[model samples]
Every structure is written in structure tokens, then in C-alpha cells.
Target chain A: MYVQEPIAILDSGVGGLTVVKEVMRQLPREKIIYFGDTARAPYGPRPAEEVHRFTSEIVHYLIQYRPKMLVIACNTATAVALEDIRSCVSIPVVGVIHPGARAANGRTQTGIIGVIGTEGTIRSGAYEQALKQLSSSNEVISLACPRFVPLVEKGNFRSEETYETVRESLESLKQRQLDTLILGCTHYPFLADTISEVMGKGITLISSADETAREISTILYDRNRMASNNELPVHHFFCSGEPGMFKSIAQQWLGEQIDLTPVVWQVPNIV
Target chain B: MYVQEPIAILDSGVGGLTVVKEVMRQLPREKIIYFGDTARAPYGPRPAEEVHRFTSEIVHYLIQYRPKMLVIACNTATAVALEDIRSCVSIPVVGVIHPGARAANGRTQTGIIGVIGTEGTIRSGAYEQALKQLSSSNEVISLACPRFVPLVEKGNFRSEETYETVRESLESLKQRQLDTLILGCTHYPFLADTISEVMGKGITLISSADETAREISTILYDRNRMASNNELPVHHFFCSGEPGMFKSIAQQWLGEQIDLTPVVWQVPNIV
Candidate 1:
């Protein structure tokens, strides 16, 4: 049955909304199924096995909807679970990491790329590896910003203390004299000002979400997954937690109303 | 057993690292179990129920480690899940929304507050409600910039397009003529420049994360949760997704080495 299948977008929390927004913008006619596992967020600190399992569960839940494609909007999940999910699912699985890395690699003029993300993401060296694999000339300098996420989460974007933290965090990267800085973590983009203030106008900051969106566009186009109709798409959201809060936030972030449903997933046995 | 209890810090993604960094700096002797659900991130867009569920799951997962307290570093997650988590867990649950709202309420001269966040977050009206609850004088004008998260996620902090998106998103808010702009979504902080550039120099941007961190410090101090006794606090990272990617980004964002371990959780049945 050639039904109009929805594209599944999953995140640890609302971070994946960035991707959903893009899908709406780029593929306005397609149906979207978004899932935010907000309960166990900040997946960067967890073990790889756990990440994979969590990702698998989410994917399994999403697949029940029979999505045409899956977009792993979370960077931590993309880094660790994308491959696993891809292997497990029959639908095409896409992630944000590679697209961001590729975008950073393309934008760097001096080949000195600076990456900022959660401790787990930074420690993984995914960007560094991607940069290296993409090109030998690009030098990746990564810094783990354990506080940036919290700062942004708390909405401390322009506080003096936030600036101080950004200053302290970027001191080493500033010393490195890099031209491009990759906002490796989806949340790091919220700290752009503190980072830009610290890094100055000479350096460029790249957001992984944007790159990932563009990548999704490419992947969909390549696979003929783009919606054929020109009508506005129906974006469905499922939260394992709270529907009202999710609707409110999704509306705010996407600048549109999204019908959100609650899905009960069977928690698999954890070893 | 006199064993050091781990404090759990959770966010949608890497942004919580900012809080983690502060905890590390302020409570050097304490142990932090930082979880970034990079797999499903940017909780700013999902439904409240999902965010609550995700937050609850993460809290439950973290509680297994027997953390002394929990920090909801992501503003959206905090806005949706804080009270629920607090009710469910014995540990003190701290969220960024109240602190940021309080700060903005205090700083607004015209009693008109402008909030920017991911579509889901802004739509939740959590900040608006919080600001109003704190003081009736505070009139909140919220705008959802769905693109901001992706821009920040893709590390397009200083890109021309990013600036343009910020300008477009703020155009409606500018009409409100508010003196204070609340960086409602944790991800919006990355677009401060674009926001500032468009909003001009007179406007003040409040970050929820910074205020939340400050609040956390205060709470810890008051509750004696702060680390002491000349012992250095150790921060441990857990990711529900990719450890390598999480670690790489952590190194870049937190400016330190984070050992990320995966914790697999059963996706609890959501009804």
C-alpha cells in the first residue's frame, strides 16, 4: 500500500524540533511524526550500550507508525545509534552529525575547526573523525562544554556569568586561533553569543541542526521521499511524557500548532 | 557508607554542560552524573507529556545511581517536567524556567517581557505563565523561532542566514516594543547576536540556564548539597545514544575530558 507515510523524527528532548521545523519548511507536504524522549535526556553522558538500546526502543515505537523515513535529530543518538538503527530498521535512517561535520568542513577556510558539544559528544571525537575522514587538511579542535547545555536550558544566554563561563570555556579554543567553530551539540547553538564574544568576529560558528536539516533534504530527495503534494503537511508529535507542555513548546519552537499524542512504549528488559 | 553521592544533571543536549561546568567549578569536590539525551534532544518542541516522560525516565535512570539531587538544565524540559519529576523523586529537582522568569521579571522596566524559544517551548506558555504568576505587571510576548535550534545545532552562530532568521523571528516581537527579551529556549542563546543585532542595544537578554545555575548553587548551598572537605568533585557523563559523538562534543563544549557510559533504559509503556 503506497500510503502517504509520515517521516519519523526522534530526539532526547525537544532538540529534534529543529529538524522537524526544517522538514516542515523543506518538505511541507509530507506527514511528520516527532518523538522526544524528554524523560531520559542529555544522552551524551550515558553509556553507548544504553544509548543504542534507548534509540532502538524509540525507533521501534516510531516504526509502528510505519514512517517512510527516520530522522535521528539528536546528535548524541546520531553519533552512537544511527548506524545501529539503520541496520535494525527497514526505512532509511538519517542523522545530524555527518551533515554538521560536512558543513563545518566545507565552511572552514583555515582548516582549523573548533567543535563544542556535550562531554560525551566531544569525547567521542565524531566530528574530528568525520573531518579527518572527509579531508586530511582539516584540523578539529574539540572542547566539552558540560555547562553550555544547562546554561541554555536555563535560558542564561546573555548573563554575565554565562559570558564568564563561555569565556573560560573558549579560552583554549581562542588560543588555538581557529576560523570556524562547530556547534556540535544541538544545544550549543543557544550559547552563540557568549562563544562569539569570546571568539570574536574572525571565527565562524556552524550549527549542526541546520546542516542536518539540509542533509535530510538531500537524503529525501535522493531517495525520492520528498512529498509530491504542495499542501501543508500534517506534523504529528508524540511525547512519552506530557502532551500539553509538548504542544505548547512545539508550537513555540515551530511557530505552528502540532497535534501531539502520547505513546506508551513497552520498556524492554535492560541488562 | 560515606560514599559520595552523584548529582544528576540533565538537559535536552549539550547545553546542560554549562550547568555541569558551573557545578564543577563551584562544587569541585562533588560528583556529577551528567546525562545528555543527545539521541532525542531539543526538548523545546515536543509535547509536554513526552518531555515529562523523557525527563521522568532520565530522572529515574539517574536515581538508580543514587544521585543526591537532579538538575533540569534544559529550559523546555524544566518548564514541562520539573514539578512532575520533583513529585516523583525524593531528590531536589531544579529547573531553569523559574529562575529565568524571575530574572526577567526583575529586569523589565516596562513590565513588557519578550520571550524567544523553540516552537514547542514558546507555545507552552510556561515562561509567560511563570512571569505572570511571579508578578502581574510582567506582560510576556513570546515568539517561536523554529530555525534557531537548527541554526545553533548546525553551528551557524554567526552565519548571515542565521542573522536573517533571527531578524525575521524577532520582527513580530520588535513590534511589541519590550525592553527585556527572555531567551526562552535554551537553544535561542546561540542567536543572541542575531537577536541583539535586530533588537538593538537597548534590549537586555536573559538566559534561563545561567539563572538556573545560580539558583542551583543557592539551593545546594542551602541544602548542604554542595561538595566540601577539600575533595575535588568528579563529573561523570552518560549518553543514551552515541558515546563517541557525545564525548567529542563534550570535549569541545565543556572544555574537558568526559568519560561517557551508556545506560540502557526500558522505554516504559506510555498510555
Candidate 2:
């Protein structure tokens, strides 16, 4: 029997933990290696070249684990550097964007789709192209929610002013009469209640994390990447920043504590 | 007189652009330096240390451009690294968490508030702490909507399935019987419609982006960071990923056209 290798997941920071959560829920038997570049995060605002350099370095770092597959849990890195990372690593590199686009395409009624994401993902037009390529008749309206991830990370999910902000940001899109909306960034799912409230009853909200998780399952199944049932799968986490903060947050998000270790990466030389 | 300097707005990615749009609408005279780290994107799932590092990098990068004031448009970065970045930089740093928490605390009639966000932010208890700190009588129930960011980023803002996702994710929070919900993540604003539908109109939704913008304006005015009437405020965008992709989606989100430029940074050495 072939020995099952772990799945390697990388993000600029802890945002990718959402992806890890889904992976754990859906594929509990598979081991995981999660790497967060805590020392340098919020990859959305940097230059593409810098993002690419950062993504490559992280992927290179994760490669040492020799996981069976790779998940780029970050939308920005997926948008700017997924292809580059794929080329650099021998493992299959899966990103959240394509799976998300595919999921959105699968479920549109009026064909008018709305997307919200970080400045990088929305600006990349990767989803637009993917949706357009998938179906020409579909109309995709994208909004760059540059603050959403930050807001979510800050723990301001339910606030009166947050609703007003939602109203203001989405007022135009609501007017567009879109039937479906995509949560382009991984961090957005946390605001599902507020988003649903603003968009009204009829509009649909699609989560890229769910779609990406489903896609990962499908891909792994097709590639026979499932782990053997000989022992419990080991999930390991490494952050470029403080291990204590990462561990605390990871426990809360995952609802169960896992081992989180700190690994410093030489950011200066990687770029 | 000092030359007019642009307003600097930064997020992990596109979510902060929502704040930029608001700032533009509320104050058209201001030039804006909007940076979306399309490269690293979505700080929601990463560790606090990494989020802090990424936040500092962007803040430092934005400072190089000499903006009048800085708006930390992301809640996650604001919660984890705002103070650190503020200390490192000379310019005034504005984060969305406190203003948003204040807004929620002020609007709750039942004194029962529900806060949701990415795992890291929710775990940090920033909003909950801020809300409770403001009013001990208020009860805050915090949950992490891990899937929302990716869904919004992928452009699936409203759909029947998305509604189902919203319903499933928020089922527990709804049981808490809270009157106010904070759109903790800037991206949650995009999902406001669906969320409102699930929670009903009786529940008020708040967004940190709008509140943060107000706070930013107030700070700019208080600190005399407001730009002078000189030349048309130049709006510049820098992405760590693809400029073309960023521009197209940005146009959709901002409801206008923007010129996005790509920059490359050495990632390996920095982190």
C-alpha cells in the first residue's frame, strides 16, 4: 500500500485557516500542513511581483513537508501567484478562485452575478474571466471589499454601523438586480448574516471556501490522494509570526486545538 | 501652504476599496492612495503575528508615498496590528474595529450584540472586548463565519444556495436573539441582503467600513491632515499581483474606472 502524504496549505496569514477548517471537516482522515506567513501578511496591498515572490517563498517552505497536494487558501496569492507556485512545485496547487467561479457559474438564475473580494482578487478579474469563459451570457458585477477581511479579522461582525456600511457598499449592486453574489475572499463568510440582510431575500450568496473545499475533495479523490486509515491524521501549523497568537486563534476557529509551531522565513532573500 | 496630499487607504485586499469609495463620495476633494495587496490577500485566516507583519509592510509602503493620513481599512489588520503599525509610523493610523464596536454598542436596544468575523478576529475578541468594555450590561455573542470571505470575493453575493449557506452558518447566532449584528468584515457588507433576510428587518446591521471612514475623516480633520484644494487628487493603485485584473474588478466595485499598477517586492527576505 502506498503511504499517504499530508496536504499542504499556505496563506499570507491566518485567513487560510478557514480553508483548513473546511478541509478538516470534509477530509478528517487526511493530514494537513498549514503555513501562515504571519511575519508578512495582508498581501492584498502589495505589488504583484512582491506577492508572487512572497507566495513562492511560502510554497517553497511548505514543499519541504512533501504533502500530497497543495491548497492556496489565500485569494490574493491565488490571483497573483498560483500559476507561478504551481510551476515551481511538483504538487498540484489548488486555489480558491477557480473553484469559487465554477461554483458561482453552476448556480445563477438571472445570470447577473455579484462578487465581493479583496482589492487584489476583484481587481485581478480572474473571477470575471472565469465566469465569462464558463458562460458568455452571465453578467458578473464585482465589488472590491478591501476592508471586509480586515473588519472580520478585527471581530466587528455585528455592529449597527457595519450594517450601514453594508448598505452603502452594496446599495449600487442591489440596484443592479443581481441574482447571485460571490464571497470572493475567504474571510467574507463570517459576514454572511449582514450580507444576506443587505442583499434581501432573493439573492444568493456563494462561498468560495465551501466550493474550494468541495473541489479539493474531488481533486484529491481523482488523484487518489486520500490518506490510509492506519493512523489518525496529523495536522500541523506553522506561522511566520507569533506562535501564541496563531495557536489561540486556531483553537477558536477550528473549535479544537491543534499543534501550531513558529518557523521564521528569510523574507528579504526570498523575493 | 503645504501641498495637498492624498488620503492613504489600505486593506489586505479589495474590501478596503469600499471605504475608498465612501471617502470619495463623502469627500471628493481628497486624493486617495488605495493599496490592495492582491499578492498576499485575505489576512482573516492567518496568525496575528503574520497579519501584523503584513499590515506593517503595507503601512510602511503607503507611508513612502507621503499620504496625509492612513486608514487601516481592514478589521483583521486593525484588530491585530493597528497599534503596532501606528507606533512604527509617524502618520495617524485609523482602524475600523473600535469605531464599529462603538456603533454597535450605541445602537443595541436589547444590549445584546452579535459579532462575527474571521477565525483570528473572532478569537482575538477585539470587538467583544471593545463592546463589553464600553457597556458591561451588553451581551455579545461572537461567531466566526469562515466561509463568507471567499464567497463574497468569488462574486456570489446573493443566491438561493448562498441563502442556505447563510442560514446554516448563522443558525446558532440567530438563536442568540440579538437585535444588532455587526458586519465585522468589510466584505460582509456585500452579503448584507441575504443576512438581513435571514435575520429579519428587526435586526440592524452595521458596517465597520462606513464607520471607519467617518473616523478617518474625523482624524484627518482633527490632526489637520486634510488635503488642501490645489490639484485634482490623484488616485493611484498598486497591487502585488496582476494590474489588469485589479483594474477591471476595481471598476466594478468602485462603480468607476481606475488605473492599477503592479509592483514587485522581494518576499523571502522580508518575512
Which predicted model would earn the best TM-score? 2
Query: CA shift at B121, candidate 1, in angstroms?
Result: 44
The 10-residue segment of model 1 chain A with minimum total lDDT is A215-224
lDDT of 1 by residue, B96-214 (tens): 77767766765567888888777767777888876664445577888777777766555567877887877887787777779888887666655666778899888988876555555
Query: Comparing only chain A of model 2 with the true chain A, what is the TM-score?
Result: 0.92
DockQ of all models, two decimals each: 0.01, 0.01
lDDT of 2 by residue, A1-271 (tens): 2347888988877788888887765455678999988777777777888888888888778788888888999888999987666666666778888767655655575778899888888778888976664455678998987767666655566798678777788777888878889988777776778999989999878887766765665445324355555456778999987677668777877899788789876544343
| C-alpha positional error of residue A126 in candidate 2 after TM-score superposition, expressed in Å | 0.6
Q: Against the true structure, what is each candidate's TM-score?
A: 0.48, 0.49
RMSD list, candidates in order = 24.2, 23.9
Q: What is the lDDT of residue A163 in candidate 1?
A: 88
Residues A101-201 of candidate 1: C-alpha lDDT, one tens digit per residue: 66565556688888888777777777787666445567888888787766654445678899898889778887886888888877666566677778899
List, residue by residue over B1-271, the lDDT tens digit for candidate 2.
2337777888877778778876764455578898887677678988888888888888878888888778888888888987676666676777778767766765577988888788878988989876654445678889899888777666677788788989999999877889999988877877878888988888988887766665554444324355556344668888776677567667887887787778776774243
